[model samples]
Target: MMTTVVWLRRDLRLIDNPALYHAARRGPVIPLYILDEQEDMGGASCWWLHHSLRALQGQFQSFDCPLILRRGDALSILQELIRDSGADALYWNRLYEPRTIQRDREVKTTLQAEGLEVKTFNSSLLNEPWEVQTGQGGPYKVFTPYWRQAGGQITAKQTLPVRDLGSQDRETASDDLRDWALLPAKPDWSGGLAWRWTPGEKGALDRFDRFLEQRLQLYADKRDFPAVGAISGLSPHLHFGEISVRDIWNRLGHFEDVAGVETSVAKFRSELGWREFSSHLLYHFPEIPEKPFRSQFSVFPWQEDEALLTRWQQGRTGYPFVDAGMRELWQTGFMHNRVRMVVASFLTKNLLIPWQKGAEWFRDTLVDADLASNSASWQWVAGCGADAAPYFRIFNPVTQGQKFDPQGKYIRKWVPELRDLDGDEIHTPWKVAKERTGNYPDPVVDLSVSRERALAAYKSIK
Candidate 1:
């Protein structure tokens, strides 16, 4: 009997999965998931990984397909699987991170060298990061122009349907899921995470459906408010590829009852463009993880304050909004996108810490912490990334809090100390007599003074 091996990676779901669809078309596919111990999947990420894999396993069992798990380097594991299973072909979806790209290239080359048929398909984003470019034929350095070009080329025709796989011979020798230990061993810190998400393809689709029916209509206006459930909390799901961008796109296309359907769809599509831009940036400038994107930023003086970084990470920073964001990130594996920008700004601009330090923290804390988005967004706030915000544009946390979380509900939920405070007073609790406490601490740095210092530092670089 003809046989093919479908290697599951980031694209975990069976529905609308191009790699799985193609593999099923070729022959009876042996579904495989290899846990590569050599790769350092971050701490917070491991929590999400465990849950996502559990969901996938349940889905596979329903279909009578065995998910064979193995531990080793991917190349060696795949080679052995192919040799032993007598699989004629191997298939997987693409990943855009720099290291993943390098690994995939080597794996494909090695597999091809061994006379094995290896195929990859695009199931992650609507467009591959390399497909979009600027007028000069290079990757676009900025987001707006890149997004416009991408939108112009984007069409509904590109989304493919999920292909059904016929029954295949069941294989034994599958490793027990418990042996992987993908979850935390002792003193499980996942209590907070449990309150936040349900990881799976079905959960992802349910979220999308709910958002489309209720929240997406107000997405443009309400997405920034942390207290409101206006934004689609799909980043973790998207990162894990439980749902495809094409699937999301098709769902949006079906909305006919909304008044400004086109505008809403356009805005949401632009957000996906941002995802593409981040990946494109990482592809071109792989060193961005360690070095600044702008050459001048290499000389930009950053303060060495591990204590301050600790305060930021532990959510002890005196700024209520900044602290709220950090705490929210700690409690849940996700943070509101607007709050993310604010906290990042506070770190690089107000605290004078290096963007890399903050990026590393987010990489460790965020369940959806993607290499491209996390690094690019941090660098953007730090004024050292491609198409980054201007160096002089630092966010004033108190004002930002008042503007975004006007009712103080978001701040209250995450920061219990400020829960009883009302309105704008919640943002600057020190001004209130009863609220002020020696225990609570004062603002770490005066906003005006720090902004001036940051501007001067950038000016010196220029």
Candidate 2:
């Protein structure tokens, strides 16, 4: 039997995994995971990965096959694995990140030159970034036109089932999961993450199912309200490829014709489209992760204050809404999308901090801190990305809190210091009497002053 080595990266799930499925059909499959040192994984991402791999490891073990774990240079390890197992073929799903793309291409070329049938598949995205194009046959800078074409092109690709491994058991030297040190140690800051998330395929499926059963109907109406639990909460799972985008897209097809679901389904799918758009933006413009997509914003005057940035990061921005979002992220490895915008705006505009600094902080803190999505989102909020919000459209943290988090439910949940205040006082604790405002810090920067500063900075670049 021809042994084919399957290199696993972000696509950790067994279902609908193209590379794994095709490799299994060919012959005996040796599943291998390499910890490429070049890849930059955040702390929360590492926490999720640790649990996700543990779950996948159990699934593979059920087939009596070892999910080989090795760390170091991917090319060197693949060459060594090929030699050891006498594998004549290499298979892997494509990753769109800039560094991974270059690395995978080089690996494919080198291995193919050595007479290996190396193949790659698109298991991560519903469509490859290049598949959808404008009429001019160029990439899209705007989302509405992009999703209009891209969404129509989507098909209901059937998810593959877990097939019999056919006695394909291979024993290889594997690195212990604990040795990876993916979880925090001395500080052990992941207590909340452990309580909040279940990082695996089963977890992903369960969340999606719950979203469909309960939240789907109200999703369009209440999705923007931070206090309402109407979100799918599948972002981290999607980022990790614990669930296939195709699978989600396929499942949504069943709800297309259902009454009252059309609007919600469209809204949800557009979110998926946004994920695709972010990837599309990153692939066509690789520098987006590091530099502004809109070049004119390159010279935008941005404040350099670590003290201010740290306050924003630690959820002590003195803006209740922004602080709540930050605190929620720290506690749960996630945040409400509405709050995300408010907090991001407070960072880049209200505080006059650079968007890159906020992006870096999120990339380190968020479980779903994808390179493309994180960078794109920060840029969008900072008015420096393709089709980004206008510079003058600043999010007043107090007004945002009043609008999305009415009654202060979301804020009170995260910002305990402001829990005692009622009415609009919760949104602006500084306005309340000092006795009522506990130890919550004063407004770090006056909102009015910062808004004008941000505008002036944008004018400088313009």
Q: In order, what lDDT does every prediction score?
A: 0.84, 0.90
lDDT of 1 by residue, 178-223 (tens): 7877677687888898877888888898988888888888887878
RMSD of each: 1.7, 1.0
Per-residue CA lDDT of candidate 2, range 33-79, in tens?
A: 99887788889999999999999999999887779899999999999
TM-score of each: 0.96, 0.98
Positional deviation of 148 in candidate 1, in angstroms?
Answer: 1.2
Q: Name model 1 segments beyond 4 Å from true.
A: 158-172, 434-438
Locate the minimum summed-lDDT window of 10 residues in model 2. Answer: 163-172
Instruction: Give the clashing pairs for model 2.
Output: none
Give the per-residue Cα lDDT of candidate 2 at 312: 91
In terms of lDDT, the best-performing candidate is: 2
